[model samples]
Target: MLWLKERGIASVAESVLNSEELDKTVAHLLVAARNDGYAQGYAECSHHVVNALKVDWDTSKSATHGVNTEVALAAAKMQFNNLQLPVMDLIDVALHSEDHVAQLKEIFPDRQEDEDEDLA
Candidate 1:
């Protein structure tokens, strides 16, 4: 945000950043903690909820009390991780996107391969 502001490209930055797609989920036991004003890593859930609702992370809070995707993605990126921000504006681009997984691979190429293939 600061960097974009400096370059007078904040609008483009604003347009580029989407929070709903940023959250990572937590374990089941952590739900009560967040409800009482505390929540563990809700990345997967948050991402699911946000992605399901198709809302921006910043504004997502307006409709939900879940984790912030934009912040999550920022932290992930600061640690040298790559988060596939929507090229235009679509969460499907992140999940069903062929580019997203590739981007994530740049960081942890060996994180985990698709195990779903075996399930079917």
Candidate 2:
């Protein structure tokens, strides 16, 4: 009887430890996902800003001898500010994207694979 009780306690302890490890893994994955989403959003916004600046500079050069540094800086700053909302929206969409789901599955495949096997 004592051996059985000790075995039961050991089993419960192992289960709790496994649960904690799983929780930690999930937390790490969520942080990674958020970082990746934010990076994608910022990269997209930066690309747009760069393309716009290129076009603006090209037009300005054709119209004038040279671009004004102060005006260019101000315009770029204003455009960046205008894009804040779109950047946030992109980040939100990225977080909920199929790519994000695939990323999570890629990072943690063993459990899902096992479940798939069980179902089959």
Candidate 3:
């Protein structure tokens, strides 16, 4: 409708209007919207958390302290434990799937190389 077009939702309105199963179409749209929102929120939160952690680490007196494996491991463990349930769940899901692991490696090839270097 003209109102939908004015509101910038004309395509969505048209899709719903053209759908044979309006309820299902609406449900699908809702799910897609929710997934998009979750992804966006997750990305924003990740960026914020990473930036905060980086700032804290950079400004900390401990930044000058040479690497201590025990301290680093403890800090990593604490950070992992502090993560939200949703984030932990997503991580678990990804780690449990070979395809997901492969996808992650593909997406973050540098990270994988860093991990390999760490092991070496």
Q: State the lDDT of candidate 2 residue by residue for 9-120, as single tens digits.
A: 4533454455654455555555555555555555556568779777432232332233343454455445544433333344356457767444333333345457899999
Pull out the clashing pairs in model 3. Answer: none
**CA deviation > 4 Å runs, candidate 1:** 1-8, 23-80, 88-120
TM-score of each: 0.19, 0.31, 0.30
Clashes of each: 16, 0, 0
Candidate 2 ranges beyond 4 A from true positions: 1-18, 55-120
Candidate 1 yields a Cα-based lDDT of: 0.43
Best first by TM-score, ranked: 2, 3, 1
Comparing 1 and 3 on TM-score, the stronger one: 3
Residue-level lDDT of model 1, residues 17-107, one tens digit each, is 5334443322222343343332334444666778999875453454335555455544544543454555434423443556654433332
Which one wins by lDDT: 1 or 2? 2
Deviation in angstroms for 52 in model 1?
50
RMSD of 2: 18.5
